[model samples]
Target chain A: MAKILDGKEVAAALKDELVAEVDRLRKQGITPGLCLVMAGSRPDSQSYINSAVKRCSSIGIDCRVKKLPEDVTQGDFLKIIDDLNTDPKINGIMVMRPLPQYISENTIKYKISPEKDVDCLNPINVSKVISGDDDGFAPCTPAAVIEILDYYGIKVEGKRTVVIGRSMVVGRPLAMMLLARNATVTICHTRTRNLAEETKKGEILIAAAGKAKMVTKDMVSNGAVVIDVGINFDESGKMCGDVDFDSVCPIASSITPVPGGVGAVTSTVLAKHVIEALKLQKGIY
Target chain B: MAKILDGKEVAAALKDELVAEVDRLRKQGITPGLCLVMAGSRPDSQSYINSAVKRCSSIGIDCRVKKLPEDVTQGDFLKIIDDLNTDPKINGIMVMRPLPQYISENTIKYKISPEKDVDCLNPINVSKVISGDDDGFAPCTPAAVIEILDYYGIKVEGKRTVVIGRSMVVGRPLAMMLLARNATVTICHTRTRNLAEETKKGEILIAAAGKAKMVTKDMVSNGAVVIDVGINFDESGKMCGDVDFDSVCPIASSITPVPGGVGAVTSTVLAKHVIEALKLQKGIY
Candidate 1:
């Protein structure tokens, strides 16, 4: 059996550290606060919100969920973001995706000040990620990938890593982050002419293509580290990953499973970013 | 002999178009203006400033040069930036890099207002480039590469593109731009395990890596579109590029020469970005 890179174990360890940090901050008269701005009623968003809130409470961090109605106007939404920006106590702000049909993400991204943008969804923070600078926070999902690698002792430096996706949130930023860590990263997408040929080169392959079972054994090399960032429904209606775990485990050295893998570590990273954001904003770092 | 992508010709043609636009803006009582901020006495920046000034004059755009003393304090330098940022008449602001030893790039990058950041140096503008949104402007060198390719009718969509280098100014932004154009972009850098092995996969190869003559004939595939963004000096004290001109040119279907290639197109693109910034600031875009 291949080494299942366990996210549950890593996340638990990370939570313990966060608890200590949260307590330390509380002693210094700082209470890290995260505001979750959710628009419309995405069932998935609600579940995600619940999980995030739970994680915040576990770490002794304050969590505020701002639920905006689906019919909220653009002006009203901007006003909400403005209030959050001025609220000195708020350390981090994360607006959930798949926002109301009328509100464009492009316009909304600027409203959330980069200082409070823990998710790194704000464009300035996005640019900072590309620059390999200290000012901006890394997006939570991509940061989770790094956390998982650090926990597993996987060497990203000088590795032939292939990222399967070109998303700004996952694939693009992750590639830059890996490069900052000294990895030679390649970004492959749906338009890639030879997906398997390209992916076979990866010593460390990250699948964020959002396609379930898309990566079979043939696509992976022997004993390569694989991370499944995709959350998809299989034919049996079960949540599976981009990599077919059963098929790939035999061929891979180590891999992250669907639910308990990257998904487990993402929210914890969000909390970590909140803490980091708080420190930077408060001139603690 | 490989077809040399003539950047000088493309730039000249672009100049003619910009002239017409500048006149149009003038008729509307908005003179398209660009303020070049040069700190210290770097010879390279001086020459670049001269060439940029000449380019602006030829295109009928207003160009102002703000030359600061090498020993100027960080506060004084930032004050100059603030003046330019608020100056409604100034359409674009170009800060010559390699600022004095004391000033940080991160601090200066933010000092330039995003609205007038013609080079896309501002973090918000940088993020906007990644977002592929309506507001942000693309940096000049990357924009030059695209312009050269578009002018030559080389297809980027669905192409296997390889970029050597990961500088925030060129390689990183170029990859995002290519990705936005639907290219399967891979970013390789100093730590890449097998640099040539990865670069060989590109149908379109871009050399922004600063190493002189690093890319040889073997690194490129036959008849590939090559764009070189390197400007270095050879042993003879003559200017050269990352790609070995004599060696790689024969194998490449199209390639840009160091002196007349990306360099010629860069300043024109910078001017074009200024016009864009002007339009955006005036609510004309």
Candidate 2:
């Protein structure tokens, strides 16, 4: 069996560090806060919100969830985002996925101020990431990927990294982040032909395809490190990732499991970002 | 010898098309105008300006040149850009290269309005490009690279493209552009170990390392299409590129020359952007 790049263990460690940081900031009368806006009610959204709120409470960070109806107007949503932007107590702002069909992500993205956009969904932050400017914070998922690598003491510098999927949220941003760390990064997608030929080249393989078992054992090189970012369901209705974990584990040097890997890290990262956003708000590095 | 991509011929064809477009726009009382801001007496800067000016004159677009002293203050230079932004006649703003060591490119890039940023140097345009929003123009060299590929009727969808170098000016932007086109792009740099191993993976190889003959025959696969973006000096003081032309020419299915490959398309692309910026200002696609 390969060494598990344990996100549960790592996230616990990060949360402890954030706890100390939040406590120290509390001494200066600073209250770290996060504002989450969820448009429409979905069970998945509620579950994520519940978990996030629990995590925030554990870290002493205030979590505010604002739920809007499905038929909310675009202007109203923008107004709400603007309100959070100017809210001194709100250090970070995150809008849950699948916002109403009528409300475009671009419109919401542009409205979020870069500083409060802890999710880094804003175009300005995206450009800063591409330009390799350290001033901007990376989107939490990609940031978590880097943190996971760092925790495992993996050699990112000069390593061949292949990123599956090219969504703005994961693959594209992650490629830029990996490149900034001096990794030779390649971005592949659904449109990519001969996927196995490309995946075999990665010393570090990242799968974010959002499809179950997209990367099989043959797709990876021997002892290659795999980071699975996929969250999907198998035909048996069980949660799985893009990588065939059972098959890949024996061939891979290290691999992250779907439930125990990235999912474990994300909430902790969001909490850490809230603290960081607080520090920035208080003019502390 | 390899079949030359013949960028000079391609560029002439593109320029001729732009000339006709300029005439059509003029009839609608929308004359494309470019504002060239040169902050020093650098020979390279002077030569580039002269070339752009002559090209614009031939194509029926009005070109304005603002030659500021090398010792000009940042405030004064920004003021000149502001003036151009407000000037209805000036549709495109271009800050010529190496703006006196004292004046940073960031300052100039920020001062130019996004609407008039023909060079696509501003953060706004940069962000737009990364976000896949068609509102802004792309950087000239990167845009030209795409144009050349399109002119040759080469399909980028699902192809393996290796971009050697990650300079914000070319490599990074070009990589994003290629990704948007559905090409699996790998970006490499000096820190990249086993550089040749990475280069051999490319169906389309873009050499932008700015080093003469850095990419040798061994680094390239047989029949790979090579686009050399490097303009550097050889040991014998000859203008060359990252790709070792003599040895790799026989191996490449199609290749571009140092002077005529990417460089040939750059200025014409800039001219095209100027026109495009003008159209944008008039609220026309």
Please report the candidate that would top lDDT against the real structure.
1
What are the per-residue Cα lDDT tens digits for candidate 1 across A20-134?
Answer: 9999999998999999999999999999999999998789889999999999999999999999998988889999997888898878987889999999878778888988876
Give the per-residue lDDT digits (tens) of candidate 1, residues B1-285. Answer: 789999998898888888899999889887888999988999999999999999987887789999988888889989999999999879899998878887788789988899899888888888878767657778899999999998888888878899999888899889889988888888888988788888888889999999899999999999898999999999999999899999999999999999999999989998888888888888895
Q: List where candidate 1 sits over 4 angstroms from the true fold.
A: none
Instruction: Tell me candidate 2's interface RMSD.
Output: 0.9
Candidate 2 predicts chain B with a TM-score of 0.97
Question: Per-residue lDDT tens digits of candidate 2, residues B126-199?
Answer: 98887677778898899989988999888889999999999988999899999899999999999999999899
For candidate 1, what is the DockQ? 0.74
- Deviating ranges (above 4 Å) for candidate 2: none
- Per-candidate TM equals 0.96, 0.97
Q: State, as a TM-score between 0 and 1, how close model 1 is to the true structure.
A: 0.96
Highest TM-score model number: 2
In model 1, pairs of residues that clash are none
